[model samples]
Target: MHPPGADTVLVRHGDLNTKSNTVKRYMEGLLAENLEAILADRSVPGEVERRWSRPLVHTTEDAVEDATAAAADTFGVVSASPCLTTSTEKDRILEVLAETARARYDGGSFAVDARRADKSLPYDSDDLAREGGAAIWEAVADEFEPEVDLDDPDLTFGVEVREDVAFVYLEKRAGPGGLPLGAQEPVIAMVSGGIDSPVAAYEAMKRGSPIVPVYVDLGPFGGIDHEARAMETVRVLSGYAPNFDMEVYRVPGGETISVLVEEMEEGRMLSMRRFFYRAAEVLAERVDAHGIVTGEAVGQKSSQTVQNLGVTSRATRLPIHRPLLTRDKADIVEQAREIGTFTESTIDAGCNRVAPDRAETNARLEPLLAAEPDDLFERAEEAARNAKLVEP
Candidate 1:
């Protein structure tokens, strides 16, 4: 029903139907601002204009492809479709429909769905659908089959006749629906270049929290390739937020680990993890972020055991959000793949070292308390301040 090349992209609110009219309009604007921010980053030319009170972004044909893909990832967007903007005249509509059909109609079974929003039009919705379907069939029947199925067809063409202009579309792509990025609260995501952490960062982003990544440099345990991997993972996460570039804080993790090794003969792992939490808190304060996000799944690692997790929690005052706390590794792996981090996560970089023997699975708070080092929080703050900004 639409022209061959799509010039307009449709963006729908994630949960507009659940909101009141006023809230719906606000959500629409919020989605637009976020998407506009996305396009602005690319320097792509376009305007997000509403059509018939619906969010339909208008972009030049040259930029439509990039805009469509970016719009699909922006939070708060439910579905996006590339559409042709045309006049409401019947002849004009049929002419473009026929031309598009001749170019793309594969002589296959297809159906037309038409809605006349401009009630001023004489014809009803069903009449326009039947008429448009018949026109497409007549125009392309010479080269292809023209079987029309009202129920289920190989292809479904759409036409919406609004007061000012009509829109035609062939496909609708799914978007990650939630509040827009920065809508909730900002969080510092502790990324380890492993599978679970970046995925946890993604979950926070999906819930509308902008992410500031903090990568702890464990020194000789992880080499240059290890740092590169961590940066790459942050870059991967940045793809989700086109409008905002995610920053990585390369905290001097070696200092904390070295201190734990020198000061604590027992519960060193737990002490090291507590250092991680303290680093997260420092980074969050520096960036004005409200909390910390981690991919620490329960029982997944010795440091992640319930008791050990509790011991680590005491290190930070800010709220710690463990998005993958209860999620299974299989589920996390599937999500990592979905978010394009699975390949990078699987790379066996030298940074991920083997654990020492007697890895404390049930790190007790009492032991950790006894082995605590002096200037622990002060060293953590210093490490945060000395962190270098790394880019992929």
Candidate 2:
């Protein structure tokens, strides 16, 4: 527990606990730092400390809600609870439990969900639950008949006893469960003004990879409004990792699209994808990123077919991570909504102006390679060199 009268938020780790001790310690340190960064960014007065593998955020009563919300949004946290803490003495524990229940419960079925993290305590989890439930019932019995419904209670008070302290909380805010940001090397994410690509970048962020967003500006094909939407989507993503000042790399891609349009008709989409991948590779090299992330899903578009995806992947040696590779469109849209990018992505970004009437779904490697401009790699390099940074 933190200082008396201060609010304490208990943050539960997600997959971080599954790692080996060394790795877990490293990740836990990163998580705490990230949480501190979040609090600082929000101007919330707080201090974060690791307690028995969980991060505990201590803040003044005025900032507790904001602190709890920040903890819930942070990556690697499965859940966060703003709790009332007291000494682990049996009488004090029951007193605080009853007080919390009285404030939250109003004439409804209730349950005491207690857990003992400190084995040294004389009472077990069941004993605490039973005693706490009795106290709560007695405190509220005068107002209304207190019914104990263990399976589905109208209000459930959670009690967690650890070492010398007990915490009682009413609600658990769900977090985006995954590894902490910066746990893995950054990825050059090929984001666009569409729904799926932004979601893909978010998924990459969720997977512990801080992202350097690369938006290809198809001058005539995708208008200035398209670039605006893409940048806006990136801005929304920036909210996720407030500690990092994310910049969007704007790669000029009109020349490459024009070249594809002039040289190849049927495989234009495939060749264009190859150009995007190559451009990403150049950016990845410059930024020392480990991989490239995209929104391509199997059979989602002509260029995203299994065979065509393979054909396009040959353009870059770095790994291509398509987070939405197997996800359905509906699910992707739902996630976009959840992450606060759906509306901006829905705004009209003109369709690909160079798309052929019928793109080759099952493109082969050799012929597609042959159709590509001899200076394709050079063009990609040029695009990467000329990329303008857009701060979000």
Candidate 3:
């Protein structure tokens, strides 16, 4: 078990200056509200407020561990810290700093990294570091060896002394830094019971696009296990959004497989791919989405080859956002694990069971169109109409 922590959480933003003022304000609000939801889950009493350029959440010291862990899931937060805060009187600041370092450092090697935001008062940043380091070393020297290694230390105490108050913290818990959820226009994401798609959807959500997940259910080929896995991935993703409103829609795709599987035997997989995009296009219109989101990474598979993506997307002239298009598979998997979807995405009996052995890698658009049925959009529209919303 970990020890109790300090009473406040110091939240730092990601790249906010580049965004427009409206977008920055919107993300700030969403990030704070998401943290508030996490606090409510733990029954922690806290209030989130902007200080300087970042958010500072005030909660009991005992709740810092829980809050820190929870805050790491929120997007737009570069990092968070459970910190001790006090008035910036020279002696008072140094006293609290020494006390915090004493509790955290157990002799070995340590260093004090101090920043002087208020230069008007007393000593500069370097002198403050030495003063704090000496105080902590003296307090902890009896029990363990105290070697002050300025270059690299086993323990580091970071101090930021503002005009009226100072913050002292040991570590910075990292969050997925991006635009917050709901900051961008809504997108209808095509999710699958696979590692890549879930991670792709997560990337879109991380960039502030509220996603309406559209799962293409492969009938008998995938049993209940497939649906369960997709929904579970969505549930895990919901942690990032906290309290955002979204839904998962499962559309029957067996009809599409039957049409392409028989009509275009040579380029059947490409036909299926086209249908998927067409289905998402129709769903996007229904949901009034800006565009469709897919998990396609460039050349991840034969079906995702640059030529193949062009062929597949031709049916849906509407914009298609492929967030993971240039990303490597390993990086996508790592991100899935970070967003809590990796384990669920690895569940049994997925749609990959139906993948063709010699699928087309560089399919041509004209040929794929010739192979597809004229009423392709009609059937795709039907699938979209049949889609029903479900809770994650």
Candidate 4:
């Protein structure tokens, strides 16, 4: 139990499989704003703080109790309770209000904001509001003396239920969450004109790491196909963040790798990665970004093995931040779902087109560096310098 000034209980809406980082980010974003509110008043002390996710994790009764405990824990909290009313169904909302209202003592007024995210739900929005409000009144009337009017009730509660989740909170403060702002300096993404890199760029932006997306338009990977994908992805991402910028680096590496593949000993994956990082570094230095961010997940495939990661990492002095590094396929899929990137990336093109069927997983650094064709790095640098600067 917490002694509370302002208790906040975060609720997990559904089985969306949202990452802890994203949730944490959203909560922080909310708290930062709410804390400022408390601070401005100078009446609430110790500031607004959040407890761990509770409502969604616990059963209905337990979630309520947990919320109460968190609120109570705050230093200056007068009293706290997890709001017990939230639902996409108006009937459910009314049912919850009628059911939970019995717990309310005298001197408390309640409000219902019937928020509807799913238009397909059975009832109209207004119907939900009226029924829900009526339910609370009925519950109060049945359980205790009817306070003539709710205008001056001792406590005020609110309910917000939408598609996939509901939030019942006494207070709605802003969240500290935005993209993890300023974690990494701006970097130019490989922007494969494919799904992964664009999605990766979006993830990078959310973290507050500025991006200079670098799309390598080889002109041979089906002309308008690559360019169209790159342009469209940047457009969607820019909608989320207006101030984004991009640079299209045209590397003829796709064709070059095809020719080189014949000369290598089944290590084409490593060779391709080498070219990618090298090209990326040239752009990174040009833009002054500290490191490159990629969508690579470790061991999801052969090319992501420990040895492959090590070899690819060697191509640049700047650190590579693989946000998806340890994520499983399911986790990555879920993230893509949240950002609207999954479908787009998948439909654009496949990554393994040029990769070997069974690329070397345990690439030795000495042989990997020593094996490749000459002037690959030099060609990459020149190509990066000429990549297009697309506005996000």
lDDT tens digits, residues 102-132, model 2? 6767777888889898898888999999999
lDDT of 1 by residue, 1-392 (tens): 23467888877665555777787667667677888887887777779885424677788777777778778878877777778888998877877777778877786688888888888887778887878888898898778668988798877787878888877777667788777776677898988778888899998998889998988888777667777777888888887676675878889877667666666655676777677788888778888899999889999887788988888889999988999999999999998887788878765633235345567778777767776786777888788878887765
**Model 3 pairs in collision:** none
RMSD of each: 3.5, 2.3, 2.2, 14.4
Question: Across residues 324-355, which tens digit of lDDT does each residue of candidate 4 receive?
Answer: 77777776677666656666556444345556
lDDT of 1 at 253: 77
- Candidate 4 residue 286 C-alpha distance from true site, Å: 1.2
Q: Model 1, poorest ten-residue lDDT window?
A: 347-356
Provide the lDDT at 168 for model 3.
82
Error of 3 at 261 (Å): 2.0
Better of 2 and 4 by lDDT: 2
Q: CA lDDT, every prediction?
A: 0.78, 0.86, 0.78, 0.56
Query: For model 1, what is the C-alpha lDDT against the true structure?
Result: 0.78
How many clashing pairs does model 1 include? Answer: 3
What C-alpha lDDT, on a 0 to 100 scale, does residue 18 get in candidate 1?
A: 78
Best by TM-score: 2
